[model samples]
Target chain A: MKIRELLTRWVGFVALGIRRTALRATHTARQRIRFSGLGVAVAIALLVMVTGLSVGLATSTTVYDDDIDYWIVPDSESPESPLVATDSPQFSSVHETNDRITAIDGVESSTPVLAQVLRVGTNESDEYVLIIGVINSPALEDVSGLNTDSLTPHDPYYGDGEYNGTWTGDAVLSEGTAELLAVTTNDSVTIAGNRSFTVTDIESQSSDVGNVPTALVQLSELQHVTGATTYDQADQFVVSTSSPAVRDDLEGIYPQSSVQSRGEMTASSTRNSDMALALAATALTVALVIGTLFVVTTSGLELVADRQQLAVLSAMGISVGSQIRLVGAQTLVLTGLGGIVGAVCGIGGIRLINAVAVRTITTEPIAVVSPWFVPYGTGVGLFVGLLSLPFLVVVTRRVTGGKLG
Target chain B: MAGSVASFDEASSSVVVSATDVTKRYTRGTEPGVLGRLLGRQSPPTVCAVDSASLEVRTEEIVGLAGPSGSGKSTLLHLLAGLERPTDGTVTFRGTDLASLSRRERTRHRLEHIGIVFQQFHLLDSLSARANVALPLVETGVGKRERRRRATDLLERVGLGDRITHRPRELSGGEQQRVAIARALITDPELVIADEPTGELDTEAGRTVLQEFERVAENRAVVLASHDRETLELCDRLLRLRDGSVVDQSPPGGSQ
Candidate 1:
């Protein structure tokens, strides 16, 4: 209770102090158009814009998965074995590489992932899609970055035609494609070359924007529709290792394939963060240099003009530090208010940008809301405020120096 | 009746202020100006504003220090008030040597014991008459309610009861000086120092202010430095100064 009372008193004093400063400031009316207030506002606006974009990009593109350590793809030079070299060079089978890689001692498990481009259609509409051939194991299904919660057999492709229990001629459509085709859980669908299928599941669009509404089909069914000669041919292999230390050991086993660790992917994300930080720093520097100068210079001149009044206050027992605090607090309050306004503007500006651009691709415009941006903007304003301290102390002492008579 | 008057002298034995050969030199550098630098006047040209000045005030004596503008009258009052340090001599207050005390000590002593009224009526413009009158007591740590009560009574005594809430700018010069007098006496200091306090008022207003000073000196010793002959006439004793030296004057109400 005592602590509560003390805190209450402290808050009251600060409020009174701020009010006094504001009222006193109005007495010096011609001082209203001070350049320092303008500088703080500009600094805050710039800080919000740069930090907001960086933070938004950081959150939007983040990937969270813990399943496979690396995905191995055939190197362009491998070019053989009758596996078509698509985006990643494909090889004949994962079993051929698995035995050689297992000899290296750290290889935990490796499986082939055959991927192909196909077109799927409902009676109402059709969309181009990427087909991933499922290896028919619960462990393979357990991989993250793949939404399994919505992968039911009653999605839009489940009806309008019969489907065999072996999942052959059966397909799945992601949530986006379902929305696009206005299709439901009992709908029937046809895939590449008019092979009919039932709608099984709709995955979440958040996993990957480019892969939204893409199909996941049985390996046999996928190979039949694409007319591939062998089901064992793989475009890539999802490799899981015992530890990060064994990545290089496995990369050596498949000399014809390129190996990349999850760390590399995480590193790419970190580079984006660093780039954002650098841009923010540059913008903050520019704002501070220009804005702080304006605030300091104007506040200094204002102090000089109020010398007599300040001396009067000092002689009446107000300390020099109190005088400086008064001025600093006054400036910070003004700048902080301006910063809040700037944040409002920044939010509006982001909405404007997304509206003008995002409507062409997606109906939903990006609303840049990030918790970290608030402090980032306030910190910029506070930095400019702290920069005004030295000027406050020097100018206060110079004005009130022992001359109240 | 004459024997009762003799007994009153014993009652007036309390020493309110005492100074001995107090000297204060102000180099033009100390005057806070750039001319001191251009002329190589690093120190204030070493002119003694108060040179070897000595005076004392008893409990109820109204002593007047009469001098021209630069004749060390105001500086001597400042020294007695402990507002400034004497360069060469000692001012002892109630058996304690004031020169030996720290700045904070001197400030405390001034706040508790000595009151000052400036020529310009140095009242805080932001404060009302009652607040200005209570200011010295406030600094002395008096309770707000008591300080206001005493300040209001004192304001009434100074003939400004109606103007208790009026700020300094709203009051006439004489009324402002009266308010300053009330402020000085609010802390009930032993000595009150007035520096040409009536200089800004007209003759009638000046006489009225001097009357208030006389009334205040009945309990506390009033040390006033003024060039006004009428003020000197009203004082218990007058000491003249010229060129930083005290000149002895005739007794009270002399033709000279």
Candidate 2:
């Protein structure tokens, strides 16, 4: 007779669903559903981890300074498929070649850079840092987002082209390095096999280098200490120039190397970034497929074993439509709960992976988690649950046979 | 047979369910495909599970179906309860033809009018005794408080008040059957069809369960299918079925 009463009567199926689903599963049925959910959680957690890593690789391909316009990297492989190798081709006579490039028109500055994961503290402690070798010049003020002008500049350690030069031992530590060693500016710390360097500045690194433990040291000093002074070997060279014609000269400096201007670098990086996202999407699809199949098999077996209970329900005058509603409600509850748990687990996993990468590689993160990853992972879980509905329908039909005893 | 047949025309408002010339036939084996038949495979045989048998059950009467295993007693009861359709003839509940209704309509018709009890109990392992009793009313859209209160009271009436929270696995065979009976009666259905209610119980448990059924029959008509001799002694009238046919019908304590 009343609007509210009519509305309540129309929504009676909701009451039926709540009363029959996992919220009121029998002890035995609950055990079955919980195991199914745990399996989905593990699959979803793995998907989240792989996707996070893929995103990290895409967004964090750079370890050079934010302002560097060109990079001369060894072109041993195609630039499109560049792989970060621990040991690779380098430029001999990099200092002289960089000096020539610096003389060209529109060239503001040029510097040779060498990056190695070398131990920083004493042998008793195990702390490795990304020791970057660069010429600290006023014209080029930053390397990997840390102030480099505080360090000694220009050939101070390459006196007479011999190993007997005055070593300033002045180093600029990234914020992460300062916190790792518990040191401040003006404090002396052991590095590169017990050679003590005074901390000149501790600057917070830019987003380009991520949260790596980094330090900027003079180029020739790093080369002399690391026994790489034979050909002035460096990993790569960063050049600052405004003229597009300057790239051709930089390319000719090393015939076997390749030059990537700012625009070209961003395009290549974008391609790599797109590939990474594609990889993450594939992993997510795989996780969802595996999760769906597992739930179907397990839930099918459970329904087969509990057919008699379904028979009982059918005999009690409950319609097949009502039974379906109850089963669908149960599946949603199980997967929804698993998704929440898996997202939480995935968040923890991302942090753990990033921490390990920082400790070992110390330059670029291997995985990064975003705020949206939680809801995304949960959505994946629900999608997996929805995928298993056809199997569930078949099982429901088989159990609720036409003839009731 | 004394007091065996009731005239169909004599049926009135007191008649809850009447099966006239009802028969149920089931195929015995799977049919061979054409290739199998070419290889000398035989055709599947058909077995008549229930012959053309007429019966009228009035409200408040305890009608017992007595037969040995594999007889038509259970099949006849199934037809009367609208649990299965008859191969021939008509089964009408409260003057409505059950065969005319769709599967969903038939189910609803059964739900609103009839209660059923199985030999194996068929209790849900996940639900407690009280929840099992309250299950049928959930589809009826009864309020939670009312369902709980009614289920609790019914469990107490069935002598399972203390076992209300216990799951079916935790209860004894007689206790579980009593819970099932309580589940059936919870909706206050007009007709109760019980198939071998004591088939899985011991002598003592069976007697206790039979006593509960006796009390259940006080409020509704009971069509009980069982082979046990003493179970039939509690019935007002007995129908003896042999080889899918009702051979004779008589009052209890009389020769079949």
Per-residue CA lDDT of candidate 2, range A274-384, in tens?
787687878888888888988888778877776766777888987676676667666766676678778889878988887787777654356766666788878988888
TM-score of each model, in listed order: 0.56, 0.69
lDDT of 2 by residue, B1-256 (tens): 3333354344577888898999899888798998999999998788999998888888789999988888888789888878788999999988999999987888888788999999989887667899888878767767667888999999999889999999898999999999999999988998999999999999999999999988988767899998888889989999988988888899989896
- Model 2 alpha-carbon miss at residue B161, Å: 2.8
Among all candidates shown, the one with the greatest DockQ? 2
Q: C-alpha displacement of B83 in model 1, angstroms? A: 2.9
Clashing pairs in 2: A26-B126
What are the per-model DockQ values? 0.08, 0.29
Q: Highest lDDT among the candidates is held by which one?
A: 2
The superposed Cα distance between candidate 1 and the true structure at residue A107, in angstroms, equals 38
lDDT of 1: 0.65
Runs in model 1 with CA error above 4 Å? Answer: A1-19, A28-42, A53-272, A281-401, B1-13, B29-44, B122-186, B201-215, B227-234, B249-256
Model 1 lDDT tens row, A119-188:
7777777776656654433334432244433343222221222223344454456565667666766578
Q: What fraction of the native alpha-carbon contacts across the interface, defined at 8 angstroms, is recovered by model 1?
A: 0.00
Residue B45: error of model 2 in Å?
A: 0.3
